[model samples]
Target: MSAKNRDNKNRWRNITVGFRVSPEENELINRAVALSGLPKQEYCYRRCLNQDVVVQGNPRVYKALKTEFATVLAELKRIEAGKGVDDELLSVIELISIILGGLKGEDANGE
Candidate 1:
C-alpha cells in the first residue's frame, strides 16, 4: 500500500469526500485554488470550514497572479465599450485584488 497521509496536526486523513460541481463552478474553484497557492483539497476544506486561506507570496503564486492579470486585461479590453461584465470575471478581479492587498500588508477592506 502507499504511504499514509496526515495533516499538520498529525491526524490521519483517511476519509474520502467528494462532490460535484458544474463546469462554471469548477472553473471558479480552480482559479481560486491557483490564486491561493494552496493544494486543492486544503483550499476546499479551509473554505468549507470557514477558515482563512492565508496567501503566502511565492513563485507559484506570483506566476498565477501574472497569468490572471493578463486574462483580466484581455477581458477588460474586450468589454471596453461599456459592455456588461461577466460575474465570474468580476469574482476573479475581486480575488486578485484581495490577494494583492494582502501582499501589500493591507486587509480585505484595504485597511
Candidate 2:
C-alpha cells in the first residue's frame, strides 16, 4: 500500500476506549444494547457520543395494534355521523385513539 493510503486506513479508527463496569452495570448495559438492536460496541459509542437513539418497537406488534384500531376508527366515524354509540364503546374508542396517537410517536395533545 502507498504510504498515504496506509496512513489513511490506519487513522480511520485508531482510538480505543473502555472502562470497567460492575456486574450489575454490565448486565444493564447489555440489556440496553440488546434493546437498541445494535451491536454492543456501536450502541455504546452512540450513547457515549450523546447521539439521539430511537428505539423502535417490534414491527409485528406495531402493525397488529394499528390494524386493531381500524375497527375502533370505523365505530368513531359512525358516532361522528350521528349514529348512536354506547357510552362504553365511546370510552373505549377514545382510549384507543389516544393509544394509537401515542404509538405514532405523537404527544397526547397531538403536538
Candidate 3:
C-alpha cells in the first residue's frame, strides 16, 4: 500500500468501545499504558486488537549496541583471516565505552 493510502486510512476513527473492569484491572491497564509511553486510548486499542506494542529504549543506546555488534563482526572477520587471536579478542571492552559515551547525552553527531 502507498503511504498516502495508509495515511488516509489512519486519518479517521469514529467507533467507541467501552467495558467495565475492577479497580485492580484498571490499575494494571494504566500501568501498562504508562510503560508503553502511548496514550491510554491508543494502548488499550492496540491491546484489544492483539497488536504488538513495542517499548523502545533510548535511540542512543540502540545505536551504541548496534555499533558494538558491528565491531564484534569485524573482529570475527579478522580472526577468520588467519590472524592470531590475542588480547585483541578482548576488544569487545570498547562496547561499554561506546554505550557510556552515547548515554552521556551526545547526539548522533557526538555534539
Q: How does each model score on lDDT?
A: 0.93, 0.62, 0.59
> What TM-score would candidate 1 get against the native?
0.92
Model 3: lDDT to the true structure: 0.59
Per-candidate clashes, comma-separated:
0, 0, 0
Which candidate achieves the best lDDT against the true structure? 1
TM-score of 3: 0.43
lDDT of 3 by residue, 1-111 (tens): 323222235664655579999996785565455445567877787888898765445564465456656766787798899977755345344434434455575655768
- In model 2, pairs of residues that clash are none
Question: Model 1, 1-111: lDDT tens per residue?
Answer: 557799989999888889999999998999999999999999999999999999999999999999999999999988996877999999999999999999989965678
| Per-residue accuracy of model 2 over 14-94 as CA lDDT, tens digit each | 456789999967855664554444567667878898975555567644554455467568877898999997765555455
- Candidate order by lDDT, highest to lowest? 1, 2, 3
Cα RMSD (angstroms) for every candidate in the order listed: 1.4, 13.8, 15.9
lDDT-wise, the better of 1 and 3 is: 1
In what order do the candidates fall by TM-score, top score first? 1, 2, 3
Report the lDDT of model 2 for residue 37: 49
Total backbone clashes of candidate 2, pairs 3 or more residues apart or in separate chains: 0
